[model samples]
Target: MDGGRDSEIAMGAYQPGYLATRNRAARGQVHGFRVALWQEHLGRDAAAEAAGDLLQPSSLACVRRMNQVAEKHWAMFADDSFRGDLPGHLMAYPVGVGSGGELLNTRDKFPDTNAKVLGTKSNILPPILTT
Candidate 1:
């Protein structure tokens, strides 16, 4: 659901209610989710950097909240089907570029998001690459 870009970009790809980024309050939540993971797993400062965000960028507080939520979910999922068996705070990522979070065991091991060196910001789009 959240594999592609932001609000309008995400909405265009699916029917309504398909994903959390479906509404305005859910706006910036994708960044918040990533912030949560990075803050908990790495640290707050690192999370901010990966997000290209600042400590008081207005939504940074929301970022912290999302991190707390994910951490809490990990704790409360004692035997839940989604993430009970995972070793630590890490969430499961999808397999390859377009797998769309297939499943825990079915997909490949989650990649380290920290290691992703994304393409530079550009007005003209970069050359596309396929997996």
Candidate 2:
């Protein structure tokens, strides 16, 4: 018998292995985005002003990098070579005094990488609030 049947008998649950794998892939994508964001923002050693221009916290480039990471995760998920699903976990951010401020999601915040890779505009906003 396949492992799926054994798992079901042992846990008294019917696990959707395919769906679980897909979810894992999705998580991987999100993780990639986090890494890309960090690299784009903190990977440089330039002056503050120059870095500001290149790595705007809310620029499209930054967002694109995040999306690219997600895409890679998706690819890995679709690949049959990976038997298990990707792990589900949240991407953590460093907290500081000035770090918790809200970022304005404007068109400028969309990364150019979206157009280059995904071939369309990416709706990557985490939901907006007006106060």
Which lDDT tens digits does candidate 1 get at residues 60-88? Answer: 66567445544544444433346334333
**Candidate 2: residue 106 lDDT (0-100):** 22
Q: Which stretches in model 2 have alpha-carbon errors above 4 Å?
A: 1-55, 84-131
Off by over 4 Å in 1: 1-9, 12-58, 79-131
The estimated TM-scores of all candidates read: 0.22, 0.25
List model 2 lDDT by residue over 1-131, tens digit each.
23433222221323244223422332344444544545453333312323333334356865555444444545444455776644322121221133567443222212323322212333773322111
Which stretch of 10 consecutive residues in model 2 shows the poorest summed lDDT?
A: 88-97
**On a 0 to 100 scale, what is the lDDT of residue 120 in model 1?**
38
Ten-residue segment with the worst summed lDDT in candidate 1? 6-15
Best by TM-score: 2
Query: For every model in order, what is the number of clashing pairs?
Result: 0, 6
Pairs that collide in candidate 1 are none
